[model samples]
Target: MAVNLAHFALNADDIPTSRAFYEKVFGWSFVPWGPPGFYHIRTGAEDAPVQGALQQRRELIAGRRTIAPECTFTVEDVEATARAVVAAGGRILMDRFTISGVGHLIFFEDPAGNAIGAMQSDADAE
Candidate 1:
């Protein structure tokens, strides 16, 4: 099972404000990507720089705000991982969905209620 933390995203109520804060504090670069109000984050690291994003906030589970940064792990199989989450006492917050060029992805909350994501990368996905 591939469990590498592949990506991290900050869910912000104010994208512009959050973008500026991160930029001023960390010197990270933000590039508009994907949909409107979403930006890809780039940390100027010489070593292993992880991918990140800044996007408009949304409820992970009905009426519950995602207050913490959610991270996604690279998995070999999204569906299998989702099943494992349920069996391990976690709840699925979002079902599998295709992200076009990205892959099949799913969102779930851990036993402690931390929102997480898992993705089976497939560049050819559509």
Candidate 2:
């Protein structure tokens, strides 16, 4: 039941523009994701696993756009972790939600206001 850093996501006002910037500046490459506005970012070789994604700002919940470079952590149980977050004086910014074929996730703010996310794998949830 250990929690681990899972993924990082960047919020962008314009996905194509952001992707181009990262590609030129950092040598990153991107592939379109499920929807029109999302793209998976590849920082290295094509065979290397994608480390993060560039998501359109409008796709995220309100107030979340202000926090770019959001870090998501994998947890044993997102619901339990969310409860613990509240008990520990943190605030839940987004309630538990599921991503089809992926997993359940929740967003929360640390006491100091840093935004973070927790995810529970779909396999584990089942």
Please list the residue runs of candidate 2 whose C-alpha ends up more than 4 Å from where it truly belongs after superposition.
44-50, 58-64, 123-126
The TM-scores of all predictions, comma-separated, are 0.93, 0.82
lDDT of 2 by residue, 35-67 (tens): 878888877555856468888774244544555
> Which residue pairs collide, candidate 2?
none
Give residue 103's error in model 2 in angstroms.
0.7
For model 1, residues 1-126, the per-residue Cα lDDT tens digits are 548988999999999999999999998999999899999999747597888999999898888988889899999999999999999999999999999999999999898878899999999999
**Any runs in candidate 1 off by more than 4 Å, and if so which?**
44-47
Task: Provide the clashing-pair count of each candidate structure.
Answer: 0, 0
What TM-score quantifies how close candidate 2 is to the native fold?
0.82
What Cα-based lDDT does every candidate model obtain? 0.91, 0.81
Top-scoring candidate (TM-score): 1
